[model samples]
Target: MDSGEKRLNELGYKQELRREMTLFKTFAISFSTMTLFTGIIPLYGSSLLYAGPASLVWGWVVVSFFTWFVGLAMAEICSSFPTTGSLYFWAAHLASPKWGPFASWCCAWLETIGLIAGMGTQAYAGSQTLQSIILLCTGTNKDGGYFAPKWLFLCMYIGLTIIWAVLNTFALEVIAFIDIISMWWQVAGGLVIIIMLPLVALTTQSASYVFTHFEMSPKATGISSKPYAVILSFLVSQYSLYGYDSAAHLTEETKGADKAGPIAILSSINLGSFFQHSETSYDFSYLYDTSNETAGAFVPAQILYDAFHGRYHNSTGAIILLFVIWGSFFFGGLSVTTSAARVVYALSRDKGIPFSSIWRQLHPKHKVPSNAVWLCAAICIILGLPILKVNVVFTAITSICTIGWVGGYAVPIFARMVMAEQKFNAGPFYLGKASRPICLIAFLWICYTCSVFLLPTFYPISWDNFNYAPVALGVGLGLIMLWWLLDARKWFTGPVRNIDNENGKV
Candidate 1:
């Protein structure tokens, strides 16, 4: 079966995504607000409005520190063996043949699920933004998707997915350029609010709310009594540091991937995390209410709008600004769309995805993965249904979104563990004198984050089905493992055999 993989290497030349993406452009377009990943939509930046700004803010700081350690370790691994398939490639090389296939399979599972969960979470939030903008237009207090008809919200969520699918499927450069445009809007939008909102009546929120330490209600209820309230705050810290590795996953397509790729990933994490620090700091918290209404499971632009327009209910100017904020939110979503295709192409090349045949096909003229791009776009549209039920099981099982991803970080560490015990010289970024100790510490932290992330928001666990977020994550992984043992083992041996270094192909 790998014979075909070999054949793909010598196949005709084709063009799709340009190979010219510079390190700066890649980082700039892909990096997003901390709120975008943690606060708005799915996680609701729980710290900002729920865990109290102080706790949430500090938690993020701790998270960022932890993030640096993890990124540094990954940077070491990535510099040594960069590949578009990301962890799977690393895992395969690090492990022996007997375990290598299993390791690589798990890595692919993690990458796929992480992408699906992350995208679904974001799309759900995007849909809510769409509804919120409409409510703003109608001047109604009805609020977002939770209040809107399920089908309608679903339509919006899926609709945005289609928009992304189509946009991402075709133009990788267009995605990067538009993302660049949106990054400015995101920065400027924040600046606009901080600067402009003050001009009109000092933009009222509550200083006390900003500093308060509160507990989450549902989670406080016996034996499963772990303090998840900590997570509500700390997760902002966790998420702020997440997703920086996405660029490294695309390293094979990047120029000077060996040196620049890992650097880009780390830089994106640092830049994004710093912005979050700025958002959560007391200087900014003073402008926010510690107990500001849970912006629900989906609604960043709405949060932004209410922050700016709520005080000016009667002022047409503030209302107009609210509209502008919504426009920018969509602009932000558009940028996310741009990168979706590349993930497809890269994943396909690794043979980690279904429809591997077509997805591996590059565009005849564009130098991009045409079929892979469309496939991801189509899935985005279909999976968009989850956003409509923002708090439902469909949307709720993502506790493993981070758990699943831990392998990406964990694999290299574990492999380093395996290798160090046996002694093997690795790359420039390889763990040096402190290799074993550093890998051990990073692995422990990854486990800690995974445990809490998997634990349900509710604590004092009653037998009321005991929220299956973690269980679901495990089941998903289990299924992948089962599949690997029974099916993926023999012929699907990752994309390594398909490498076309001689032809400069991934």
Candidate 2:
């Protein structure tokens, strides 16, 4: 057996996932999961409505820096204990023995829930982008003929989710290659739009308009003050920066995971931030000149339509850009499904979840977590059903994902920095003396962002417009606590070692 396989055995788990992914492929999976077009394009209009250009541009920079620190901290932990369980494994290993079980249980559920919401949000965006592309091609406005209905969009979302689930059931090498292709597609496709949009436009916004311009729409007027508007606008960038932990979750399937895992996590964030800054800045500039009352509702789509109106035949250029983005979103959902199912499989293997035997099953031929993949897909579809009735469901899902993901990230970093600092054995990718302070900063940043996510997205919040992130998160946590009290605490430990003498190794 190889060293990586030996390490897995020493940790009391057999090597189950196919370890065929090289460093580049590992990084590609995480980068694809953090797809720039999928996150930024869908939410561009909302940011414009709140904080305008200044916040949209600068908030991205600020969030990227803090997000890098968070990724760095997680990368450090991942180097020491590379496992599919990721944050939950880090929490259990880094915390005191007495508190380990509770921490792992909470972290596992938070990460799983966050991943489900993240997957749903990506598919949801792709569905909307597809609908928008159809509208643009048909030359149909809201008042025009043949506009698609919300039910159709919901069907699209569900169909997309199922497609991702099916795609992920393939062999590991196939998915890895798909992710590598997705990485280049995002890089090349993003550069094309960022450069072409400005060059094609007849009139471009000046640097002042792009950097200093600020406006608050009437929809945001009564509900949000200027300062709060800026804070809320950060969501556009913050949401884009998450899901980088897909790297850590795939560690079991990655070669040289102790080193490659950390590199994948940090590199994904850095590369994603680079492309996001370029694409979003240009996108914001384009919005500055073209944003009318109607355009404000779908900023990116309208910007494309306006910029290439007369340049290309039949608005083909705009449709192409939309299709590129739609394809990126589809690939992103596939990567997320892969990551989420691994988390489900890991948790189930530890018997931390109900029906553990079922979810823990690996496909005999493909060597993938087939059942877990479908379960995650089903949950994503159900979570997204609200979009058929309320458009604000997107915002709620975004907030839920942000809060749940950051919460999962924070617990392990907290344990590493404050709970078990001396216990941590730094791997080859160790941060040395800087680990504690960096983790502390990352934890604090997570706390601040989690608070931001809980705030109301709009004012005069009624049942119809209320952000259900808190409610959904609350119910999830309540169930976890109830499960702990009733049953889990009796038999569930942090992790169950399958190999003999495993307890002695720790």
Candidate 3:
């Protein structure tokens, strides 16, 4: 019979197998899709202050700078150690085992939970966007409702989750194929929209009217949305840039795994930033707002139809964008599942979880963790149901995801810095001479974002502000801390210490 340590080694080997991602395929899949889905212009800044389109536009510019810093920090870290374990691996190897196990657990907890929640929002956003396009195409109107019915949304969410679960169950190569094809479609669709929207607007309306006469349509915050313009604008921009962190999450799967992953992430954001600035500055904000709405309401569909592709009613453009973005989102969402499952699987190898047997299952056929995919999907579906309650459900979930995931950023960077100071391995991609400056800037960016991350989601803060997003985030992290103290420390310790590779682990 195998001893305890031998069994742990066996499980750890399986986790490594999952990390063997195809580099070229990884880049093609990530670049094409993340760029399209995340390039969503409407949600990025318009969701901002409602204070004015200009403010949201500026906020995006400002956020892009800070976002670049965060990306740079992540790039350096991923390059140093491009393991599938992500930050969890960094935590385990870089710190002493006793503390390292718990620290890495925190990273995994944030990643697993955050990705699940983030995916839920992605599903929600993609669905609503599609819903908007459909309504616009058909010119359908249901008086006074901001969204589709609860039942319909729930059913659709479940359907998509199942589809995602099935796709993820196959294996990496299959998933990569789907993502690559969709990524190209996504890139073409996004550029077309970016170019077409402005040209169409200019030909239809005077440039002055398109840029100057655009109006604000802020969702009610029960306070004057005007005075706190910057805060509101920041919130709006936050919506657009919220999940680009997924690029870092995919680091383990990329070729030159460590370096390319972070570079791709930062690069994608840079492209996204450029597009947002160009598109927002020139495109008619009014076309994005009331009366001349773009993708949100049916009127925009009519305007687009009247403007760009009337005969097809812009359906080809709209549907193509939707399909590309949805496909992007699905791949990103699937990455979340795979990452989450691995976290669970990794923690299990270290004896950090319950039901380790199921979540840790690997497919003999596909060589992927089929169990982790479905398990994470099942959890996401359960979590997604809360959206029926109020608008806050989505915000709160997203906010919590951000805090957890970004916290993933902050903790690992700090831990890596301290380890380097103590003379750790420094791995294949280590910065060496570059470590101090990179680590310091990383430390600074992480601290700054974590602070900015505290501002109320609804903005225009007050006693009645009652924003629960920050609350949800705090509770989520606290629970993770609590879990570590309660259990993780007992069995797991630093990447199955004294790993003997000569004979192969399993």
Candidate 4:
């Protein structure tokens, strides 16, 4: 066995996954999963409505820096414990022994729910983008035109979710290669939009308009002033910057995981932040000159169509750009499925989920978590069903995802800072003296953002406009606690290491 496999054995687990993913492929999965198009395009209007271009541009910078620190904290722990059950495993081992099981249970469920919600939201957005493309091709705008029914959109969402499940059930090498291609697609696709949009625009706004212009909606239900609005605008960046933990989830299949895993986690955030910053800046620059009604209506799509209509001679160029974003969302769904399935499989292996034996089974021939893949897909479909009743359900799912993921991230970092510091051993990718301050800052930032996500996105508090994140999170946590109190605590210890290597010196 190679050194990585030997290390896994020493850590009390056999190499059940196919360790064929190279460092680049590992990074690719994380990068592709955290696609900017999926987050930025759909939510662009909300950010603009609250804080306008200034916040969208500068807020992302601040959020990215803070997010990088969170990644650093995560990567340090990942280097020491490179496993598929990354967050939960870290929480369990890092917390006090008396509280480790509960901590692990909470972290596991939060990560699982967050990932499932994430998958649902991405697929839902992809479906909407697909519909938009169809509408655009048929010459149908928001005016009296041939708009598709809600059922059709639901069908498209389910179809996309199925596609993700099928792709993940394939050989691990196939998924790895797809991730590599996804990385290129994200970079090249983003560059095309960044360069082409400006070239095609009849007129571009000045730097001052892009950088210094501060506008807010009079009807905004949330924060009103530009200063507070800017802080709230950080939500867009936080949502997009997530899923970088996909690197840690795929650790079992990654070569040189201790170092490679940490690098992938940090690099994904840095690279995604750069691309997102560039794209948002350019889009907002042109959008500043467009009609407020149009900018507020469809955000990125309308902005692109208006800017490039003169150059393309029609809406054809704009449709092509939408297609690029749709493709990125599709790829992102695939990566999300892969990550969520691995987490489910890991959780089940330790008897954390209800049908542990079934969910934990890896396909003997392909070495993929086939059962968990389907389970993840099914849950995503159910989670997305509410979108049929209320389109804003997508927004609610987005909030739940942000809260769950940020909470999952925070638990381990809190433990590392408060409980594990004295006994913590530095891994190959240690942060040295800077670790404590970084963890503290990351923990605080997570708390702040999580609070932001819970607030209603729109004012007046109508049922349709209300954010259901708290409801979803509460129900999920309630069920987990019920299960724990009823039976889990009696039998469940934290992670059940498969092997018993005395002193880990095998």
- Give lDDT per model, in order: 0.56, 0.81, 0.57, 0.80
Model 2 vs. true fold: TM = 0.94
lDDT of 2 at 40: 48
| Clash count, candidate 4 | 0
Error of 4 at 311 (Å): 3.1
Model 4, residue 376: what's the lDDT? 93
- The digit string of per-residue lDDT tens for model 1 on 256-364 reads 6566667777887676565443231222232233233323333343344444455555435544554455545455445444444555566676676777778888767
Residue-level lDDT tens digits of model 4 in 1-506: 65556666766787788888888999999998998675445363266667666667777778888998899999999988888889998899898999989889889998998898889878977876777677667764544434457888889999999999998888978888998888898888888887887777877766677688787774544555655677667678878888999999988898899889999999998888886543333444334332332323245566567766666657788888888888888888899899999999999989999889999998888989999999999999998788678847777888888888778998999989886566875668898788889999999999988888887666667887777889888888998899999999998888988876775532
Give the better candidate number (1 or 3) by lDDT.
3
Each candidate: RMSD? 5.9, 3.0, 5.5, 3.0
- Which candidate, 1 or 3, would have the higher TM-score against the true structure? 3
Superposed Cα deviation of residue 47, candidate 3 (Å) = 2.2
Consecutive 10-residue window with the lowest summed lDDT within model 2: 288-297
Tell me the deviation in Å of residue 334 in model 1: 5.2
Q: Per-residue alpha-carbon lDDT of model 3 for 383-454, expressed as tens digits?
A: 778656654455555566666666677667777667645455433345566666676676675565555556
Runs of candidate 3 with Cα error greater than 4 angstroms are 1-20, 32-35, 44-49, 96-98, 142-147, 202-219, 222-228, 236-270, 277-324, 420-422, 427-434, 451-454, 459-466, 501-506
Q: Which regions of candidate 2 fall more than 4 Å away from where they truly are?
A: 38-45, 142-145, 218-224, 276-297, 310-313, 501-506
Candidate 3 positional error at 319, Å:
5.3
Candidate 2 — which pairs collide? none
Model 4, runs deviating above 4 Å: 38-45, 142-145, 220-228, 277-298, 420-422, 503-506
Looking at candidate 1, the ten consecutive residues that score lowest on lDDT are: 1-10
